[model samples]
Target: MVLKESLLELLKIKAIANITIKELCERADINRSTFYSHYSDQYELLTSIEDEVLDELQNTLQLYNHSDKNETFEMLQRIFEYMASKKDICQMLLSDYGGRNFQNRVMSITHQYIIQKWEDEQNILKSHSEYVTLFVLSGSIEVVKSWLSNGMEDSPEAMARWINDFTSNGLSCIPKNENSRLK
Candidate 1:
């Protein structure tokens, strides 16, 4: 655990690119042998940390996946609450300093979930489902990243409410007949 703790602490102040295994071992007060026992390199240690966080997030989201339609909003609220509880780590992983791979992984997780939800529904986005999925996933992730960047100024419930509202009403806000004009 010392290695993970040390890596996280180092990540807070420095980008992963600048972090070396020797530095991590020094900060962790562990010898190179001990570090090598756990991870072969700095990148391996960093990835292990990322895998743990993603696993936790996936588990949390899975808990709400089977809920009833009426509980959708509540599920969203709980998801935000879960993220809030892990704000420090989430902020670090979602930060600009966080590698593009990590950010893309987060989006991929969300995108897959949305796709599953759509599959479970009777009336799904029959038209351009791929684009719609990306639109929704990207929009949601951006909002979350912005919230985390602001140090999560709003309560999780409040942020969830805002997000849910936007998602629920966003379609109606778009001009329904815009396609006709293009023709």
Candidate 2:
């Protein structure tokens, strides 16, 4: 925790470009070797933080699936709610805001969640499925960006309804063949 806090504080000072493992260890009062024992490098530490945040987000999403009737809308609500709770971490992650890499990360995670739920868990989505996953990924990124820019004043349930209604005719409910017809 000390080492993590030390690194986070340093990140606050400047972009990761200016920080060094030596300084991180010094601030944490941990041995340089101890830092190595825990994390391979500074990049590893950053990636670990991202993983930790993503795990929390995924866990919250899982809770929405516990009841069959409450999955989709609840999942959207949970996403905004959970992201609101981790606002600082998100602010750190999105500092560059909407960069290609960040967009890719969000899309990849959303796709993974959909695949895991509709395909792997229930064995429903086709083995060759790419169309729906891509649609959901693109749509979700756009939706999230809008919510973030708006300050997200809407309640999670209302956000969920917005997502549900938008997606109703947008992607999830549409057949893959219909998707091909669009483009």
Candidate 3:
């Protein structure tokens, strides 16, 4: 716990990639040996931060029931807000440590969000559910990544509306033939 606090302090000072164990130890008031005892390197330290963040996020997300599709919007906004809270860490994670793995993790989270909701609702459990899940997950991530990349110009509330609108329109576009069951 102390080490993590020191690491976060160093992260506030500079980029994660540039933070050496020696500096972390100094900031943390621990010896080099203690730093080594805790983590392998800076990458490991960042990974630990990621793990902690994910744990918190999961807990926060679990609080919301799955049946509410609107929670999807709220969740993403919450995540963005979390990132926004840690501006320096966000800069480092999004710029350096984060990449395809990050994107996959995000898509997986989005999928879980919807699947849980779908199960609770018991409304769309077909095998083709994967299609819809992937569609929403990927598209939503793309929108988020774009928002982050664009300096988060739009507030999260606005972004959620953008997503809700885009998704609702796509749902409306299913043709009459595909809607045969509805009739």
Kindly list the per-residue Cα lDDT of model 3 for residues 1-183, writing each as its tens digit: 777777666655566667788877887888898788878997787688667666766776787754555776676567667766765445545443343444566567657866766755767765667787788777776666567767878887777666765665675644468547666
Clashing pairs in 3: 66-117
Ranking by TM-score: 1, 3, 2
Model 1: per-residue lDDT, tens digit, 1-183? Answer: 888778778878888888888889899898999888878988788788788878876776676652244365676788788789888777777765557767788778866766667656635764655677788768888888899888889998887777666666775544457558654
Q: Pick the candidate with the highest lDDT.
A: 1
lDDT of 3: 0.67
**Candidate 2 local lDDT, 64-87, one digit each (tens):** 652243577777777778777766
Best by TM-score: 1
lDDT of 2 at 49: 71
TM per prediction: 0.81, 0.64, 0.65
